[model samples]
Target: MEFEVVVEGAAGALVAERAGAARVELVAALVDGGLTPSLGTVAAVLGALSATRVFPIVRPRGGDFVYDRYEAAAMEHDVRAFAAAGVHGVVVGALTPEGAVDRPLVRRLVAAAGGLPVTFHRAFDVAADPRAALEDLAGLGVARVLTSGQEAAAIDGAPLIADLVRRSAGRVAVMAGGGVRAEDAADLVAATGVEELHFSGMAAVPGPAVHRNPRVRMGGTAVPPEDERRVNDPVRIAAIMAAGRAGAARRARP
Candidate 1:
């Protein structure tokens, strides 16, 4: 089984790699559902890990997955930039006004990728029809899809995840993500039969104790407490991987 962690910086990437992650999806402002990280951050993460694959999610802004033409162009440019900086792959997604896969834009992004594998992001969960959306992505030659089966958590959506895996038939990889946890790893994997699992092993710890100004907030109403920061914990990550591997072993039993 392969484990992929969503990380915000080089530190988190190192922690994930040390805890046996096969890949890391680099991003920023995870509070905003992950935004395109700066190129410098991308370079730092790539330089920090020797073997762990890095797939940066290219989302210019959050709120909605529907992107305008300029945002589409920005996404394409970001993919090109990340590719140039030596990322293993890039994660991206877009949807039409009618809640379908934006095929033309994705096709252009894939072409811009120039050969690196493209993993469609969680926007597939929002598409009106998941089965047809999977086919559309496969037709576009996307290498993978990150989804929670349209549920808030992968374990809760195992049935759909399993269906996608069966439907894919190895043509596209279906990675179970979205609000995944260490405790549910074994059951999720055993039920879904997914070889790849994506999650963020976030545990809140005290941030800088010194609060310069408690009244001032960087993110306005959406700001998390400045006293603590959520990060991928190594111990939790290792445990999750072990649990997942156990599930995989059970799955392989004749």
Candidate 2:
């Protein structure tokens, strides 16, 4: 019944830890669905949190899951670096042109990770055949698979997620993620029999009013304002954690 928070920077990590997150999946450019965070950001988060484990995402870029040779090599290097930096684990994913798990690249990344566990990211949800992809990942000894059962929101994919959980049979951990809401935490857990849940738990807050060039945006119109930050909220995170634990308990009751 552990909660994993998806966070971008040190501030978000601290918020997650305060809300009882067992661990966090650290990344950058979360608006791009999370890119690799700099080592400096990782260090800052590691220095800030005492109890919560930091597992930084090793993604090279945010586009498609299918990566080129250079991108794959960079991912391996990042995994090894994160391992040396004392991260608990690394989150990563790769797919072939045919939309299947890239076993060769993933195997290399896992080897570079040394003793650290590796989590296959949501790219599993986009696989041509999720069931077969899961089998491939499990065979490669991937520690876990984060997916929404090929749906945009985990709640919508509960049935497929539950089926995956039953099929896993403890061979690999099946983590439910993707638009996971606090209100649905207990029901999602109870319905899917998933022990791990992942979500951003973020809220947009106005930042310091020290900006002069408001007209010049760092990103496009869709991106948050330059002075606004999207950060994890402690209240939402705690509620989800409490509800998830309760759900686990209820299911355990014979």
Candidate 3:
């Protein structure tokens, strides 16, 4: 099996690459569930990675997958920028107000990708119907879909993920993600039957400054400034990759 690690910046990408990750999903402000990374960050990450495929998230903001016209345009612009930066792929998804895949908008983004592969992000988890959404994305020629089967964690949603994988029938790859731990890698692969897995092997690290602010806050009520920043851990990533390999080996046995 292959592992795709979610990274916050170029530093995290480098760490994940060194840890044997096959792919890295670059993003900004992961505390907000990941917004689009800046063009400079994308370029730096691409420059640092040689073997690992870089797929930057194209989300303009957090909160909801429903995007306005302006937001959609911004996402398209970012997609074009990343493609120009020589990224391997892009993670993108947009939903209608009614929680359906926004196919028209997604088509625009995919076109702006300039022939690079696109992975429909977790917006699939919130789609009104996951099976229908998967078919729609396949029709759009999406290379893969990253989802946790609409549950809080991939293991918890393994049944749905397995069903989706069986239903896809190789039309589109289904990548299980969300709260994927190193210890559970084998079980998740066995249960979901996914050839690829996505996860944030993140651990909290203290900020650079020695002193800390007591009252100031950079994020909203959900994520506070003093919550300690999270970065990708190489040890955890390697462990997950090893476990996933073991699982894949098991599945390949006759």
Q: Between candidates 1 and 3, name the one with more favorable lDDT.
A: 1
> Model 2 Cα displacement at 145 (Å)?
0.5
Best by lDDT: 1
Which tens-of-lDDT digit does each residue in 146-209 have in candidate 3?
Answer: 9998999998999999999999999999999998998888888977789999998888887777
Candidate 1: stretches off by over 4 Å = 209-211
Q: What is the overall TM-score of model 2 with all chains considered together?
A: 0.97
Model 1 error, position 9 (Å): 0.5
Q: What TM-score does candidate 1 reach?
A: 0.97
Per-candidate TM equals 0.97, 0.97, 0.96
Q: Is candidate 1 or candidate 2 better by lDDT?
A: 1
lDDT of 1 at 100: 95
- Residue-level lDDT tens digits of model 1 in 1-254: 88999999999999998888989999999988899999999999999999999999999998788999899999999999989999999999999989999999999999988899999999998999999999999999999999999999989989999999999999999999987777888899999999999988888888867746677777777768676699988888888888888889888889
Q: List the residue pairs that clash in candidate 3.
A: none
